[model samples]
Target chain A: MTSWIAGVDVGGGGIRVQVRTDDVGLKARDRGPVPRIAGAIDTSRLCGRIGELINSVVESGARPAFERIAVGLTGMPGLVRPAELADQLRLHVKTSSVVVASDSVTTHLGALGGEAGCVVSAGTGAIALGTDHRSTWNRADGWGYLLGDEGGGGWIGTQGIRAALRFHDRRDGGSEALLRKVEHQFGGVSAALAAIYNSPSPIHSAATLAPLVADAAHEDDPVARAIWVEAGRLLAESAFAAARGLPQTYSWGGRLFDAGELLLGPFRDEVLKRSPDAEIRPPQGQAADGALLLAARGIPAGAIAEPYVHEFA
Target chain B: MTSWIAGVDVGGGGIRVQVRTDDVGLKARDRGPVPRIAGAIDTSRLCGRIGELINSVVESGARPAFERIAVGLTGMPGLVRPAELADQLRLHVKTSSVVVASDSVTTHLGALGGEAGCVVSAGTGAIALGTDHRSTWNRADGWGYLLGDEGGGGWIGTQGIRAALRFHDRRDGGSEALLRKVEHQFGGVSAALAAIYNSPSPIHSAATLAPLVADAAHEDDPVARAIWVEAGRLLAESAFAAARGLPQTYSWGGRLFDAGELLLGPFRDEVLKRSPDAEIRPPQGQAADGALLLAARGIPAGAIAEPYVHEFA
Candidate 1:
C-alpha cells in the first residue's frame, strides 16, 4: 500500500487539509480559523484541528496514521514553536515525520514548485517570499494589517471603506458608488463604523469589503478602479522586493487575486516595469500542495533554518 | 455670594474641570478617560467622574452647586443622552443648568470663540466643524481611526511606524531615523508591534508615537517631514471642506498643533491654496474654555440642534 501523506493550511480565514497517496487525494475544509491565544498560535488546538480534518478525509476503516505530515500556518514566524507543533502533530496524526513552517514558505514552494523564484500571496493580508527552499530566503511585507500588508485584501477594502466615508462626509476623494455599496452592505455608514471598530477581528472584517471594491471597479467607478490599480502596483513591488537575489521568475496565489485582470493587469505592468526580462507565471498549486510535496520529499538541503521550519521524526 | 459656573472637557486622555465665579477659577483634573461601554458613552459613570472632579476642586464646607455647567465630551454625538446625564449630575454636582455637546462643537467654539469660521481639532483624532452657532453647521472628518480621522495624531503616528517597518524590511519608503527612534522607544520592533496591536485602545497607542515622528522631523528626516507635511495638508483640507459655505476664517485646537511650524507651515499654505483670502489664527483657548463660555452664555439661538447639542435645566 502506498504511504499516505497529509498537508494542512492554517490561515486567517480557516483550516484546510489534504490527504494524498500516489494514487488518490482527498480534500476537506473547516471554517474555524487556526486558534490564536494572546497573539500567538494555539499550537495544541491547531494540531488537533488539523488531525480531525485529515482523519475525516481519509477512509474510515483505514488507519488514520500517516507516513508524513506537513503544516503551514499564519502567525508562525517568531511566535510559533514549530518543534512543539511537530510533536503535537505526531501525537494527533500518528505521523513519524512532520514539517512545520510559515505559510509564506509553503506559498513560495507551491507557486514555484520548489524553484528559486518569488511568490506573492494576497488574501486578507499580503506577503512575498523568495526562496530555493535553501540558504536563500527573502521576505517582504506581512507586517500585519496595522503596519504593512500594503496590497492585500485588507488594504484594498480599507481604501474602499474610507472612500465611502469620505463621500458621506462630503470630503475630497469620495466615491459615491462605493458609498452606496457600503451603506447597502452594512445598513449605514455609522453602523458600519461601529461594527468594524468594535470587531474582534477588524482586519478580517475590513477585508470582507474587498469584493465590494472590485465590483465597483468593474462598474467603472474611477475611485474604486484607482484603489485596485494602486493595490496591484504595491503587490508587484512586494514580489520584486522579495525576488531581489533570486531569479526574476514570479507567481502569485491567494483569494485576492481572484479579482482577476483588475488586479493582474496593473500587477503585470508594474512587474515588467521593474524588470523587462522578468518571467511571470500563474501558480502551480497552493500552500497545501506545497506542504504535501514537502511531506513527501522532505525539505531540500539548506532550504530553511530553525525558527522558520522545524522537522520531527 | 457669587454663583459658580463649571466647564468640563471629557477627552480620550482624561477629564478636566474648571470652576469659576468671576473672581476665581479652580481647575481639577482626572486621568480617567470618559468611560465607554459597547461603543457608546457610559453617561452615568461619566457624570460621576465629572462630579468627583468638580467636587474635589470646591471647598469641602461650601456647596458644590453651580449656576450652570457645560460638558464638551468625546464620543457624545448620537450616543449620549443629555437628559439622563443631567439627572445623574444633579445628584452629584447639584447643577441646575447643563449643556452637553460633541467635543467638535466645543473645539470650534474654543478656537473661533463662537465666530462663524472653521476649526480643526487634531489630537489623537481630527475633526473640522464650521458653524455660525446659528443655522449652518458643516462637519468633516472625525470618522474615527479606521475609516477617517485623516491628518490626526493617529494618522501621523501610523505613517511614522509604517515607515520604520519598511526600513526594517528593507523595502521602499523606509525611514532609517524613524526606525531607530521607534526601536529605541519601544525596546524593539516586534515588541512595539505586539503592544500596539494588542492594546485595548490601539488608536491612542499609535497616537502616542506622534511625538517621535515630530522629533525625527526636527532632526531633518525627509520621510518624517513628509509625513508632517501631508498631515498638515490633510488637516487644512478638512478645515476648508467644513468652511465651504462660511467665512474663510480658520483656527485650530488640540495637542497635535503643538508640532508648531512643522504642522502649521503646510497647514497655512494649503488653507491659502484653497482661498487666497483665508484667515488663519491661533486658538484663543482649550476645549474647557469653550465649555465655560457656553455655560456662561448658553448655546446661541439656532447654533445647534438635538443630537449635536442638548440643554437641560
Candidate 2:
C-alpha cells in the first residue's frame, strides 16, 4: 500500500524530474528543456512541460504508480498567487493529489531535512530562502538574472570580465598576468569583441570566463580577487536577510547547508566579523530532494540525524 | 602653402582615420579594427598603431604634403605625462610634428569652436571635458568602463536589461513586452543563462543590446524608456559636474550625443527642473576633427565659429 510520488524542479534553463516509491525508493529521474509553446512560454505551457516530464517518468516502467506529484519551480516569481499556480498545474497534469512549492522551499527542505533553516542558491540566478519553526517562509533578492543576482556565478563572471577589461584599458602597471590569462581564455580581445557584439547570448559566453576569475584569485590578481571578495560580501548580505528572525533553536543544517562557503568565504568572514554567533552549515541534500520529501508528506521541523532518506542509484 | 594633416580617432570598438588638406579639403577616410601588436595591445602599442595609421595617410599620396598628425583616443585614462606619450608615438612614424591629446579634448575643441566650454561624450564610455577662458581644463567621470561610464549607451542598455529582468521576477503584470523582447533577442532564458555564465566580455555583450533597448523605448516600453531617461539624467549629471562653476556652457559629443532628443528628452526635462541655465548643444565635428583642430598650429582663438563645423559623408 506504498504510494508513489513525483517531484519536478523547473529552472530558467530546463526542468528536472524525480520519482519515488516506498518500495523502490527514488525510482526514475530525468531532465528536459522546457518546451516553448505559441512562440513563448506561459504558466500553462510551463506546467505542460512539467506534466510531460512526469508522464515520461511514469511510462518508464516503474511500478507502484504514483498517487501524488509535487513540483518545485525556481523561475516562478514570488508575487504569483499560490492557489492560481496550483490551479494552473492541475490543468496540465490532472491528478487527485498534487503539491506545488517554490524551488527554494524544496531545496531548503532537502538540504536541511525539511528543517527550519535557510538556503542560498547562487547559480545563474541568486536567492536566499528561509523557513521558521512555524513554517513562516521569507525570501530576498532573487530579483532575476538582470536586476540583482549579485554574488551568483553570473555576477562573479561578469564582474571578473569587467575587471580584466578595465585593467587592460588602464594599464595599471601590475595587471599583465590577469590580462594574459583573460586573453588566452577569450582567444584575444578581437574574438572577445566579436562574441560580445555579434553573438546572441553574450552573458553565456562571459560566464565561461568565471574559472579564469577563480584562477586569477588564486594567483593573486588583485582586481580578480577583489571581485570574488565582493561577491562573497554580497552573498552574505542576501543570506543575512534570510537568516533574520530565525529562532536560536534552529541552527544551520550541517555540511550540505554550508555550500555558500565555496563562494562566500569572504562574505562569511565579513559576517563573522560583524556577528560573532552565526549558525552556518553545509546542506545534505538539494532542492529536488526537498520537493520529494514534501510530496511524501514529511514536514521537516527541526534538525534530524542523517535526514535525507533517498536511495541513490 | 596649405599643408595636409591626418586625424585618427580610436574608440573602444574601432579606429577611424580622416585626412584633411587645404586643396583636397577632407579626402580619404578609412575605418578598421584597432590593431594589436605583439599578440596584445598595450598603451604603447596603441600609440604606435596611431602613428602607423598616420604614416599610411602620408604615403597614400594625398597632396599638399602633410606636415603633422593628430591622434585622439577615447578610452585612454587621464594624462600622466604628455611628453612620454609623444615619445611613444615617435617610435613608429617619422614626423617632426605630432600631438597626442585625449579624444575628449579634441571633441570639446571641435564642439565649442576651440573656445571655452564643456564637452560630454556619451558612447560606450562616458566623460565630460571642460575648459575656462583661462585654458584650465577639467574632467569628470570617465573612469573607464568598469567604475562608472554612466549615461552612455552601454549603461543604458545594461540598465534596460536589468529592469526588464527585475520586472520579470516581480511578476507585476506590466513587463510582458520587455520580457518577450529580451527572450527573443537573447534566444530564451537558457541562452541568457549561458551567456551570463560563459562569456569573456559581458559588458560588450550588454552594450550590444543597446539597439534593442532603443527599439523598446521607441515602442514606449516604460522600463525601456526609463532606461534612456535615466541615461540622460546621468549624462546631465556629468554635464553638471563639468559646469560646476558659474555661467557654464557645454556641448555633447559621442554617438549617443546625437540621440539628444530621444535619450535626453526626459533628462533635459529633469535637468531644467534643477539647473535652468545649463547650455547644452550637439558637437559640430567628431573626436577626429577635434584632434585636427588641436594639432593645427596658430589658428587665432575664437576664429572657429560656435558649434564648430559639421561635415559628415
Candidate 3:
C-alpha cells in the first residue's frame, strides 16, 4: 500500500486540493468556489469544507489512503486557531496526522523550497511572513480588507477606480484616458457605484481593475502609473518589515508573483534601496504542495525537512 | 412677512436643523435621525431625510413664511448629482430657492466667515476646499471613505485600531498599554471586531476610537502618538494641496477644528515646515450657518462681498 498525503489551500475565492502518494506521485487535484456562509465562513465551516475536499481527493482512488493531511488557508480573517480547527477536522476525516497553518506559511515553505527566508503575498490581500532557521517567525501587514492590507490587488484596484472617479468629477479635463477606461470598464458612474456597493465580493470585483491599471501604467497615465509604482514600493516595505531579522536570502510567492518583471522589477528596486543584501528566489511549488510536504512528515516535533520539491514527479 | 432661511447640517449619524429667521433672529431648532424608508436609512434615505428635516424646519410654525430657504449638508456622498437631489427636494417642499453643494463648501463658507479662504474638514471624512476671491474653487482629497478621505477621524481611528491589533497579534510582550486600552474601550478583540463590522456605520464606530487614541497619544504611547502625529501631517498635506494656488490667509472648520490646539498644534508645526506663511484662522460659524448665508443670496448666484469674517460673533 502506497502512503498518501493531502494538502488543501482555502482562499477567499476558491479552494484547491492536492493529493500525493509515493508511488503514484501527485495525482488527484480539484478546486471549487468557496462556500458562502451567511457573512463569511467561520473556522469550523472552513475546516469542514477543507476536510470534505480532502475526502473527495482521497476517494478519487488516484492515490492510496491518506495517512496525513495538511491544510493551508490564505485570506483567512484571523490567525489560525490550530487546536480548535484540528479538533473540528477530526470529526470529519480520519488522518493519522494533520498540520494546520496560515496559507502564508505554506506559501513560504513552497516559495523558498522549505528554506529559511521571507515570502510576501500580494493578492486580493497582502501579507509578509519570514522564518529564520532557528524557528523564529515574523509577520507584517495582512490586516484584512477593513484595515491595512496595503500594496495588494485591492489597493491597486482602489487607487485606479479613485483616480478614474476623480477625473470624472474634475470636469476640467485632466485624466481623459483614465475616465475613458472607467467608462469602458464599468459602463457609467451609476453602474460602477451600484456594482461597488451591491457586489457579493466588492473587493474581488474591484481587484479586477488592477490589470486595467497596469495597462494604464503602460500608456502613461500618471495617476494609474503612480498607483502601480506605489504598490511595488509598499510591497517592498512589507517585505522589508518581514526580512528585518532574517538572513540575506528570501523568497516571494502569490498570484502577483506571476507578473514577474512588471511587479517584481519595481519591488526589487525598492527592496534593494532599503535592504541592500536581500536575495530573491522563486517558489518551488504551489502552497498546496508545501502543505502536503508538511503532512508527509508524520507527527514530527521539529520542523519538517524537504518540505517542498520543485517537481512533483 | 419676514424672509426666513433654514440651515440644515445633515450628517451620517443624525440631522441638525438650524433655522434663522430675519424677524425672530435665530429661531427654534430641532433634530432627529432619518426615518427608514424600507428597513434602513441608506445614503439616499439619509439624503431624503435631510430634505424632510429642512421642510420640517420651514413648517414647524417657529417663524414667518420665508421667501427663500437655504440648506447646507455636511455629509453628501458626492456632488455629481446635486441637481437630481434638488429636483427631489423640489417635489417635497414648495420652495422657489434651493441650492445643493458639498458640506465642505458650507464649512469653508463658515470658516472664512463668508469670506474667500480655505477650510479643511476632518470629521468622519476629510477634504480641503479653497475659493479664491475670483470664484475659482480648488479642492484636495475628500474622495469619500472608499477612496481617500485621509487625515480624518475615520483614517485615524482605522489606523489606531490596526496598530492595536498588530500589537495584540505580535505577542512580543510589550504594547500592554495599547492592549488594555483596546479591551477597556472596545471590549475584547471579538467585540471590537464585531463592532467594526456589525455597526450601522463602521466609519462612525471607527471614529469613536479617535479620542482614546488621543488619550494614548497624551500618555506617550509611541505607536499611538505616531498615529495622531501622522494624521496631523496628512491633514497638513491636504491643506498644503489646497493652499498652493491661494494666498496665506486661510481658515479651517469641521469637528477637528474644535479639538483646536490638541489637533492643530502638531498639524500646524508640520504644515509650517513646508509652508511657513500660512495664516490659519478659526471658522466663523457652523457649516449650517454658511449654508444659510449662501441660500439667502440664492443657491447658485449667492456671492458674498466678504465671504470670510475674521471674528466668530
Using lDDT as the yardstick, the better of models 1 and 3 is 1
Model 2 per-residue lDDT tens digits across residues B230-263:
7887777666656655356667778775554777
On TM-score, the stronger of 1 and 2 is 1
lDDT of 1 by residue, B19-95 (tens): 99879988999887669888688988888899888988888978756889999987756667778878888878887
**Candidate 3 whole-model C-alpha lDDT, 0 to 1:** 0.66
Candidate 2: tens digits of C-alpha lDDT, residues A1-313: 7667777666644776777766554343445544444423356766777766666656445433456666776544332344555677676555556666667667777767766766777665567666652545556566544456767766776676555544544422224666688688768855665565344545455555667677777787777777778777766666666666763212222111133444557866755664468666556676667777777764344523111111111
Off by over 4 Å in 2: A1-126, A129-147, A150-312, B27-30, B36-66, B78-85, B133-135, B171-174, B258-260, B298-313
Report residue A84 deviation for candidate 2 (angstroms): 39
All DockQ scores: 0.68, 0.07, 0.22
Shift of residue B1 alpha carbon in model 2, Å: 4.5
lDDT of 3 at B73: 58
Select the stronger candidate by TM-score from 1 and 3. 1
| Ranked candidates (lDDT, high to low) | 1, 3, 2
Give the lDDT of residue A19 in candidate 1: 88
Q: Ten residues in a row with the worst lDDT in model 2 chain A?
A: A304-313
lDDT of 3 by residue, A80-105 (tens): 45556667777777666666667887
- lDDT by residue (B53-108, candidate 3, tens digit) is 65664556543444555555543443324545555555555555556656777777
Question: In candidate 3, which residue pairs get closer than 3 Å at backbone N, Cα or C atoms, i.e. clash?
Answer: A111-A283, B112-B308, B113-B309, B114-B307, B114-B308, B115-B307, B115-B308
Tell me what fraction of the real C-alpha contacts between chains A and B each candidate also makes. Answer: 0.56, 0.07, 0.20
